[model samples]
Target: MRGNILQKSFIALQWKTSFTSQYLVAPTQVIKSMNVGNIRFIADAKNSGSKLEATVFQDDHHRDGRWWNISTEWKVACSFVVAVTSFFLNARYERIQVQKEIKLNRIQSQIKDLYGPLYGNRLVSDTSYRAVMKSHKGLKKYLSEARRKKDAEMIHCWRSYVWNVLYPLDKAAVDLILNNAHLIAQGEFPKEFEQLLMHAARMEFVMESWKNDDGALESAKRFDDDDYLEVSNASGLIFRTQILTHVKQKYDTLRDEQKQILLDISSDKQADDILAKIYQKVTHQDL
Candidate 1:
């Protein structure tokens, strides 16, 4: 009886030792290859005699592995969310900046138009005139020579300048003619004065049409094309010429007394002087 008990104790010790060795030394592939029955048998054997908790160790390892995988997945998710948020924020900022720049440019343009000529004349004191002359010295010299020679191209160039810059009809100038329409109709103004006013009004109409129909105001501000300048000048001249011719034809159909009134108005020295000063202001030149 004593021998059998000792032998049983020895066998139990060996079994425990074998189970511990297998659990500790088994590779993942070897553990995976074990059948459910084998695993259960090992677990039962380990539970029966061993004080070391093999099942507890395995449970702790599984929980730790699961926690590690969850941590990794959460970190990746957080990074992606932060990246998307930052991208949207940056895009929104850029859009706001662009809008601010556009508004600033518009305000600057309005300020320039209101005060530019008052600060410096384009033909005389402005830096832009010097810059243009410096950059196109040859062209300037050639144009001067051509003007002296009465070249047709030079004449056309000067005419373009006159229409585009000298005789440009702004709101103030347009208002002047529109407000004096009663005087024109009553023959209280000279035929020459009436024709000039008609020309200015028609040119204003043409400019407004171009601005509204062709969306040319923004392009005109750029001043990058000689062709556009030429077209604008020619268009202004043609419109004014047509209107003036019509007015003259109508005047010819008027009675002798009306014609005499127009002649008397034209011959008024004081009125002519006032008209000349107004023309000088509009054209920025000595008439």
Candidate 2:
């Protein structure tokens, strides 16, 4: 550095000496030309490669260059950290989204296909049974004394109302419960729901006993005690306790979960979009 600076200084001195000797007659013009030439020489020397060294010695661009390297490195590290963090966060976010969607789908199946129909069946069963029981002498008395004595009123009510109305409703409820056991929250389901199926099964045999007897009068017209089918396991279900209350509670809970999951999914989408923008700006890449 010292050698280079000294060489330029010597050249400047030669120019000054030449200006003094050669331009003595025309000092002003020669001095102007010499000054310009000397300045150009110094500039050329500085441009030759001394600029970087000079800048370093003067504590200028060297620090800037170092600081730029540091800045770029910092940005790279920041990008790396952000990339790693985003990778894990996005993975976990997708996992949670998958879980929420799975649960939401399950609830949808329950409400739309299973419990929804079962609940409607419950309403029909409860309303029809209560209405019929209200008008008649009640199911127990009608089946026991009235049915045994072959009472006209009981037989007419069975043929007209019970056989036509309640039978179909009960069959639907049983079929729903039987088919959709997978959606049950308690896995095995409440005994009441089981018992309802048992009741329906027995009632099916009782109603269809006419067909079993080849259309005979006693078997076709009446529910004979002799033709009672003993359903296995004695599973019992009460529509009110098992279906009405349980299904409502389950349906409401699932609906709430579904609503919350929808909100979470919306928020997660927003978060993912924001993260994608940040990642693009940081790493200069698309999601």
Best by TM-score: 2
Model 2 per-residue lDDT tens digits across residues 82-130: 9999899879978888998898798788888777888778877777777
Model 1 poorest 10 in a row by lDDT: 32-41
> How much does each candidate deviate from the true structure in C-alpha RMSD?
29.3, 8.5
lDDT of 1 by residue, 1-287 (tens): 43564355446645765677744332222112223222111322233442232221122334467788899999999979989997998689567657655644543432233222212222232243344446446334645555455455554454454446545433333454455444243445445444555656656654553443465442333333342343343333323333334444433433343445445545654665897889689788634
lDDT of 1: 0.45
Listed in order, each prediction's TM-score against the native is: 0.25, 0.65
> lDDT of each model, Cα atoms only?
0.45, 0.61
Please identify model 1 stretches exceeding 4 Å from their true place: 1-15, 18-56, 59-61, 111-114, 122-287
CA lDDT, candidate 2, residue 278? 89
For residue 167, model 2's alpha carbon misses the true position, in angstroms, by 1.6
